[model samples]
Target: MSELSLKVLAAGSLRAVWQPLMTSFTLQSGIEVDTRFGPAGLLRESIEQGERPDLFASANIAHPQRLKALGLASRVEVFTRNRLCLTARKELLAAQPSWLALLGNRALKVGTSTPLADPSGDYTWQLFDTLERHHAGLGEYLQQSSLKLVGGPASQSVPNGELAAAWLIRGGQCDLFVGYASYARRLRLCKDLAVIDIPENYNIQADYAFAQCYEAANPLSDFLLSTAAQEILFREGFARNL
Candidate 1:
């Protein structure tokens, strides 16, 4: 273990790839990283409340930009990108004529993370907006009906190593969940669940951004933008920031 250390606060969606990424970083730079993962918006609230980590990575650019605006951070960079996806029970998917029709079904429960507290929820809302633009009134209907299942301050904690979407669906909490496409690979492994891709026309691109909260994070920050790190992100289902 290195005496030189860095503290990182990252979005929960990064949890799958973060360990390997940091391990590589530590091997190359001899700096140990202590990281915490959570909803990006709630993580930002902690920063605003004086929980200063050396680095802060968010699922959306807005939170990091807010930190920069408040002078709590510097050098906001879009590190990677993701897209919104819908995960539903396999049976439910087969019964519906289309994914959009599945969502439009009044009796089916729709689950989403809490908006303003989690970027996934915000992106899901954006998807709803796109749906409404094409279908009229659909966005309002979803916004009004979607259950705020997780990612809020009051939301239940998902068990370690369990995908929330899978857990929720298996528990019969919701018929479907709107979340990040990065988890599609893992979610697909669940026998009873199906991952549905949001069309390019209706999908929202989620920009994952990071900022340097302290000078100690500079090396890691620079490394994140380097080819080595970008390649790792690419393999982990994230698209590089072009």
Candidate 2:
């Protein structure tokens, strides 16, 4: 039988989870997969611009739903869940970090993904909105204070598939980054980085969704939702969809 070749455009944050799964899938199915990793919104734009990949895996449900609305995808399915967290240099924070204090501190540089271009950014905005309910004007303050470091019109280019949040902190571009908890865990492996969990009340769940852009069925899509795949996602710090 001829080997099958498939194209997959996935969220950049899925690198840690997807790479191993893809390798296992190729070995078992004799499929050759070509993958592109980036901010979900940017990849969605590419698809709208006529780039057709076999599958689209987004960091949030909204992006895949947008594709479904545009007739680019037949359906959207929730694959995994994530939560927002704060990532910063260990030396930049006190012994016990508080989200409120960190965000309200004007002297510390805060970074977030570009809103509308990355679901992480969208979730961060949602978090800000939630914060507004607790403290008047705080939401606007955070929005204005945060540096849009990735996944936007003017985002800086990152090399070697490094995440924008990690790159920014490593280069001293920003003192802290608000991003996915899974990403924070990945970064926490670095000696100098600390991952702080957001309070439950302020945390926004990031629901990842995926769709097959083309009519053809891809086994990998089904595989992603299987028990084996969910296990990998869980091990990588993603919360499984119940």
Candidate 3:
């Protein structure tokens, strides 16, 4: 590896966008990046366990903020935003009258990431809370019945290029999966599935944040917030930090 190269730990949801973003950054800045993408919370644990990457990009602000609080990182900033959505088997869609009905069906399975090990899971939990607030007992049922299928330390790894929600739902692992809306477009392409948006009132907004673990990553950090990078993120299913 080049001495000027930087190691970056980023959330798995960024995998699709990060490639193009980094390509542009390297072309302009002449700095190579070695990136590992996974559940943001697990990446944070790796950092806490002495695996030091020059930069950490998280799916949620909380994980990065926790690192900053632990004196392991600097200047947490929200770089992008995402929202939660549901991906369900096409057969399930035909059976249920609505996404809400599909979720409330006691026989159908729901898959979610593991909480505390992945920020996506945390957001899934938050979405459940919103559901409970609006329709008492519904959220609690989801929380109880949902399968923690991915994102935990011991969870099965999602094949590198496959969309987890679609993969799981197609394999009959779950009738429905709750995950980042960033995958909405690609998931929609799958013939076996349907992407359903969580209503704005019930959806949880995911704030993607990043922090520099080493001063050497400062330029990369600055580059991420630039107009070029922001545009790429927006094109790839993320929103500019508002």
The models' CA-based lDDT, in order, is 0.92, 0.85, 0.91
Q: Which residue pairs in candidate 3 collide?
A: none
In model 2, residue pairs whose N, Cα or C atoms come closer than 3 Å (at least 3 residues apart or on different chains), thus clashing, are none
Candidate 3 least-lDDT 10 residues: 90-99
TM-score of 1: 0.97
Error of 1 at 120 (Å): 0.5
Q: Residue 186 deviation, candidate 1, in Å?
A: 0.7
For each candidate in turn, the TM-score is 0.97, 0.92, 0.97
Off by over 4 Å in 3: 1-3
Question: Which candidate leads in lDDT?
Answer: 1
lDDT score of residue 50 within candidate 3 = 94
- How do the residues 1-242 of candidate 2 rate in per-residue lDDT, one tens digit apiece? 12388888998888788888788778877787888988899999999999998899999998889899999998689989999998888876764377677777788888999888888899999999998899888888988888888878677777775766778988988988998988766687788888888989889999999978764545877877888888888988898867
For model 1, residues 1-242, the per-residue Cα lDDT tens digits are: 13499999999999999988999999999999999999999999999998989999999999999999999997899889999889999988667948899899999999999999999999999899889999998889999999999999999999998999999988889999999989998898899899999889999999999978988898999988889889989888889878
Candidate RMSDs in Å, in order, are 1.4, 2.1, 1.2
lDDT of 3 by residue, 1-242 (tens): 35579999999889999999999999998999999988888899999999988899999898888899999998788899999999988877776858899899999899999999998999999999989999999999999999999999899999877899977987889989999999898998999889999889888989999978888888899998999999999899889865
Of the two candidates 1 and 2, the one with more favorable TM-score, higher being better, is: 1
TM-score, ranked from best to worst: 1, 3, 2
Candidate 2 stretches with Cα past 4 Å from truth are 1-3, 161-163
